[model samples]
Each structure stands twice: as structure tokens, then as C-alpha cells.
Target: MDRVVLSFGDSLLRSSDVSLLDPPRWLNDNVIGFAFEFLAASLSPPLSERVAFLSPEVSQFTKCCRDEAAAFLEPLALPCKDLILLPVNDNSGPEAGGSHWSLLAYVRRPPGFLHYDSAPGTNAHHARLMARNLSALLEGDGGFREERAPAQHNGYDCGMYVVCVAEALCEQHLRGCDDLILQSITPQYVTRKRAEWKDVIGELSRKSAVAPQP
Candidate 1:
């Protein structure tokens, strides 16, 4: 079967001008624009074969509820044998129904913000976590290894943590899938701002990273 590249996320990875409950459109626009571009660029065939983009527009009606986008990814989980591209029952075979080649690129605001209020804090944490997850997926390739990158649960991890994860994932897991390409496109300005946010959070993680966790 052809390898599949799944791009899954909220407005950040899906919509460009869509709105959430909160206002302050500039920040939201910036966040969503960056992800949309990244996925567009990264999904190039040479980088990956089959590409499936799941965004908030379609997600709003799904049972997963935009907040639980990750759970919606269950269908893409490939058994090891499939992920490795090896015939099942062979010496190099992986677990049954576990070897499908797929990558889940999720983008969204942080966990809280719905009940109380969410600002750049939620964006920052999610950004950090996204980098970490993407990096792990890229580095592990189709291996699905546990993530070892540092915790950027908050925005303080310098976004580099995510970059580092991506760099590593690209080096390992992505190597075997010759066609495995997972690039995240972002404009120079958004990229710069995200970096700036990371710096700010890094300096004040202990004092300012908290965002009324739900």
C-alpha cells in the first residue's frame, strides 16, 4: 500500500481566517497561517506519497469534537509491518495491523482556554508540544518510538525543542520511507514571533507558563 501522510490540526493547521470563541484575530490568524503553509510545503509527494489533511472546518462536525482531534487519528494507525513496508509474517514483520506508514500532524490551541480564558499562553504551550510531537514522528519515522525530547508543555522550551525533534525525526524514521517528507511551512514573521514567544516563555516558564489548565 502507498504510504499515507495525514495532516491533522485545528485552525492553526487547517483554516486561515476561521474564528474560535476568543477574539484578538491577529494572533489566531498568525497561528493558523503558519501551520497551513507548513503542511502545504511538507506534503509535497517526494516528502510523502498520499496526503490527507484533516482540518477544523471538517472537524467541527466530527464526533471527536475539535478539542479531541488526536483521538480522531485512530484510523490512521498502521501496524508495524505496514509502517515498515514489510510483508506481514516475514522475518522482518511487525505486529499485526500495526505497520502502516502514516504521520499525524496535529495543530491546535492548548487544552484549556474554553472555560476560563486563553491567550498566547495556550498557543505557546501547544507550539512547544507540536514541535516535540512532530520531531518525534519525524525522527522515529514509522517506528512510533516514545518521545524523548525535553518538555515544552509550556511555551518556554524555545520552539527549538520542537525543531530539534523534527530534525531528529527527519534523520531517522523519515529515512526509510524514501518518500517520507513532513515539512511544516511557516512564514518568516510567524516563525520569528513563535521563536520570540518561546524565548519569553523560557525566561518565565515557572512564573508565566500557567494558563488556567482545564
Candidate 2:
């Protein structure tokens, strides 16, 4: 499963000059950040503009002082838009502690923030902290709400679940679906998505080989 995600990331890096740095194998415990970059790059313009994929370092900084965190985010000049997908990690050391992923999605037509967590109880505090930080970053506009997304059935699939939610939300936004409900992305669905991504990676690799290089 990890290899599948990494291969997808490799394809994205080859296809575009994304902001995410090449992930080191030593950081094998997590590849969710790279996966999010791939998803963000896959989206079309404007919709893609609305999403901000934060590095694990930046996401981790939000857990500390609010003013400092806001300063870190403000310099990025992120688009204040309909949705911001954030991947969260509970621990600092790469191999030391457990990690979970979540999203801070903003719905503009209704004007509110929705914190969607795949593993609900485990990361509630992390999600709220992120919401508060985001609210502060957005200059005191608060109305952060929590919505229980489809829960993961096992321990290791949280990263994949994050990718699933991001994809579903992007589709919903593109189709103009109000409420932005996450689809029924079961574990079986994730397995299938992995297979699909494998094929995508192969196709992209072939295209990259033939395309003229700058």
C-alpha cells in the first residue's frame, strides 16, 4: 500500500514541478503529505487554487503558539477559499508516535468551516486545534464545525482515507454539490483506488518518456 502511494507521488513529481520536496525513504512511516500533493496537482486550475497542501513541518507548527503559527501560514499567501485540506500528525518523531489525517474545509456559499476526520475520536483535539489556528489565520472569522467522515476500519489506512476524502470533496466541489458530503469510501474502495493509481502511474510514466523535455 505504501509503495502504491509512493509510486503515485513519483508520477506526480515527474509530471509537474510541485512544491513538495522529494520524500526520503527514511520518512517511510508517513507518505500522506506526498499523496496530498499528488491530489492537489491532479485538480484543474481555480479548484486547485482553492486547496492548500501544507508540509508536515508547517502542519505540526500549528499545534504550538497561535500567533507564531499564523505568521508561518501568512507568508505562504494561501488562497482563502472554499476548502483547505490539512494532513495532521499526532507525534513529532517520524517513527515514535501514531499519526492521523484530517481536513479543514470551508464552504463559501454557506460560509463556514467543516473539520472532517476519518478516525473521529482519535484526532478530535488535533482537528479543533487546526480549526482554531485556521480561524485565527483567517482573521477571527469563526464558525468551525465538525462532521464525522467515514471511519477507517483498521489502523494503517488513515493516510489512504485522507486521500479519499480529498478526492471526494474535489469531485463534489466540481459538481457544485452543496454540503460536500464524503462518499462511502470503504476499505475495499481504497484497495480498488490503489489498483487504479498503479495503472495511472504506468500511463504517466510512458507519457513522460515520450514528451519533449525543456
State every prediction's TM-score relative to the real structure. 0.27, 0.71
User: Model 2 segments beyond 4 Å from truth?
Assistant: 1-30, 92-97, 178-181, 201-214
Residue 191 shift from truth in candidate 1, angstroms: 8.9
Which 10 consecutive residues of model 1 have the lowest summed lDDT?
A: 81-90
List the candidate 1 regions with Cα displacement exceeding 4 Å: 1-33, 50-146, 153-171, 176-214
Q: How well is each residue in 62-167 modelled by candidate 1, as lDDT tens digits?
A: 3113334344444644211111110001011112211111112221211111100011232333233333333232223322222222333222222223333333
For model 2, residues 18-124, the per-residue Cα lDDT tens digits are: 21112211121234555566677877897766766665556667755567877778876553666666666666443324556566565554656677677776777
Q: Name the top lDDT candidate.
A: 2
Candidate 2 RMSD to the real structure: 6.5
